[model samples]
Target: MKKVIIPLALCLITAACGGDENDGKTEPEMKISSCYVVSSSSGQSENFSSPVGMYITSEAGQPYEGSGVWSASYNSGAWAMDKPVYVTKAGKVYAYYPYSSNDSPPVLPLDMTRQTDVLYSRVASPIAPGSVSLSVKLYHALSKLVVSVKGEEVTGLSLSSPVKCRFNICTGEFTDLQSGQVTSTDGRLFVVPHVTVGKEMIITLKSGKQYTYSVDGTEFRAGESYTYEFQLNEDRDKLEILDISVEDWINDNNYNDYLRR
Candidate 1:
């Protein structure tokens, strides 16, 4: 249960509406009594447990005025489907990610190798009876550093610099952020918070071995993903960078099956 304090203006706009004349028409649609909040994400399956918070403001008055905050939890398993979210006013709807109380942009963690789920979307309101769908696009705020060791048992791993990722909560977009050296015990993969293309990565193995990999020339786009395979060169005492590959974030091994559907 995340907590948030919305300004009264947004609250009023979403919760109710004031009586106003319409070109000589008598009654405005008595405030929007109910609505449905549908959620969708590009290249991803449905998240039935994720909730979305929103506010609907009337198009008649100042845009987004007097709207109150409301929450809608998604319960559907079908991708790109609409869920029910009740609203008092029938206007434009503003929706944000995580649906939790925290409206701030998401902070990418140091160890993203295990987790890489972050997405957000917004829908202009006036939510209809059943088809008020809010399409959310999940963006990868972090870049993947895959280090596949073929010869030696890796005892430890750490980056030469820490990667810091910054993104816009409103737009679900990642910015060009920098990273510093951060240590990690996760050897196979490093889910870095920031884009670390063309940077220096220092890897340390359990056998008291260290290798510095110059990130490939490929740039790490926000929504895209990349991989670096490293191996132990038998001819030499040090490690070697095998190869670097890039692909759409949705196509990573974690999403191979779902994206195909």
Candidate 2:
């Protein structure tokens, strides 16, 4: 029988040396202040950066489980969780509510899209110095809707209700934050939907004459987007659905709702 010999150092190399893939590499670190310590019900806070508590998970596309620190601050002798995390790759940082647990990511309620109740996420990479103040911007996680009309005789348009609060935002999951609204003579209305179902919306279109259209059921999905285009035929007797397309809420229009706070 022949005996085979293995090197002890080689057997332990993977465990000791390769365990830390980010070793020696300059990794990005989230600023402790970037995570809001407290938020007001009105979505505005004067001491939003108090650093009272925060739970964060930094992952490269996959979900992670992490615990946050309470009373997190730059003060000496604080919990390790209070410290910033170093990143090996560009990814998302899901920050939980103050003193919240990381058993799961935060959930947006069905009615959370209301301006009075807005939640946000933090996205950034290469977390270098000054990046904390300059590159970091909060974003709302909701969907939006826009409607427009085109016709030779069309003069004005109005809806019985504001187009902003039409859908149920609780059903589907959303990835990005949403805000802003605009209306024009052509019937331009921007809305945010918190649910995935459709609603019966009534609209009045006016040109040389006035016409009413029942947008009986228009569906708005979460994390997804939509735009409705109503075209008036030559007779203008009926409004036709010229197009319904998906839109990227980020690049489309106003997101200054944060400024109001």
Candidate 3:
């Protein structure tokens, strides 16, 4: 009777230890199968730059709980996180390029002088557990302005527009607006998406000549590109509007035809 009781006690101890081991085991890490940027106009997909910032929240507008944000770096033609991320429950994922170091929801100030192509993506779905794969697609969040001179060479070009705004990374919204000026020599400027009413484009020639033109009521939208071609008339000392074309930032089929004067 003593031998049987001792053996049973040892068996119970072994079973208890096995149960603790099973409870201590963690869930499998979530995997990101593919991450790429999709062109809003062309529907074409491409890989974004390395090191995109990601944030996972339990719900929309909810703050990230637990460990905080994750960094997804480009590796071997794929985007991967620096460490393992476990999505034990349902949550939403947000990703953006030109990763900001800020832990909170990133709010980027609009700077026309040093413009960059801002890309963002949000996935609002239940990410199941047990080695789940995620596919992310980022889109452009700003408008592109391209100015081309057809007739004469210009020394300087500047735009007097709304240069003040704040871009919210989580919601993909722009707020806090003001008016200012931005100078560009290459005639290419990445600007915040807004209406073009009352905005002015100033061009200075090599002979110290300056011309200012008011842009009409054209609303610049996100992921769109606007091209303005001007022919400098030496005889009249005036700038003639040769053509104005609007296309996607990725340069796809022109949605709007040329507006000629």
Candidate 4:
């Protein structure tokens, strides 16, 4: 299980909310796989879904510097009706903020999703960001998920984890806050959290984008420290399940794939 403590400074002062894009119009994507969420004070974690597009945001809202050497590319497989696209200033896009368009503002593939059937119980972020400096740690987990990011603007093109949970709500859901239902009429598809009358589970992420991703699971367990980052497609969902060590997650080819959709 991963453990974290909301900073005393953040909790005492009027700290702005991170991860969950409560005020923005977009959020990368959040998932709940099979990792455990245990508080440092309690040592408890939860198991949830994992996706590919939310990894960039894991670098935000930390106490140290963050940086990374990874990026999400566009690819196509069984789920895509047409070939997936790699978005750039010169590529065809509609807006560059939400959808991928071959025309219009020519929005790039800024918003993408990848799903998997295998279970990921651990994760590490290479991009960790702070207020002034970013010291990205290689994918590793000695105590918690490590990340490094050092930029004014962070974009969450895609993020994938072995498990997903509200960073603060590692072992449970963030209830009490009223949740507003937002729908994408554009027909883009992604996973969503389950909603209740007074209990709406939401995960705010970096990249200045926040979206809904919910999971219904029971518990989680933790393995030894591990790390890995290889390939990810911004246009598709992803799942990776296997053992890893620092620097091993990226180059190791012995990973087991238990999902094919």
lDDT score, candidate 2, position 129? 34
Q: All candidates' lDDT scores?
A: 0.47, 0.41, 0.69, 0.23
Order of candidate numbers by lDDT, starting with the best: 3, 1, 2, 4
2 or 4, greater by lDDT: 2
Listed in order, each prediction's TM-score against the native is 0.53, 0.37, 0.77, 0.17
The true-structure Cα RMSD of candidate 4 reads 25.9
Model 2 / residue 105 / CA error / Å:
9.8
CA lDDT for candidate 3: 0.69
lDDT of 1 by residue, 16-121 (tens): 5543333343322212222222221334543433454454455663334332445554334333213233433455555543344534323322223324344434
lDDT digits (tens) for residues 138-233 of candidate 2: 333444445567744344444332333322112224445433222335443334443323333344554355555554455443234466677777
> lDDT score, residue 109, model 2?
30
Which prediction has more favorable lDDT, 1 or 2?
A: 1
How close to the true structure is residue 71 of candidate 1, measured as C-alpha lDDT?
53
Model 2: colliding residue pairs: 140-177, 141-176, 141-177, 155-207, 168-194, 168-195, 169-194, 169-195
In candidate 2, stretches whose alpha carbon ends up further than 4 angstroms from where it belongs are: 1-119, 122-140, 151-199, 205-219, 234-237, 257-261
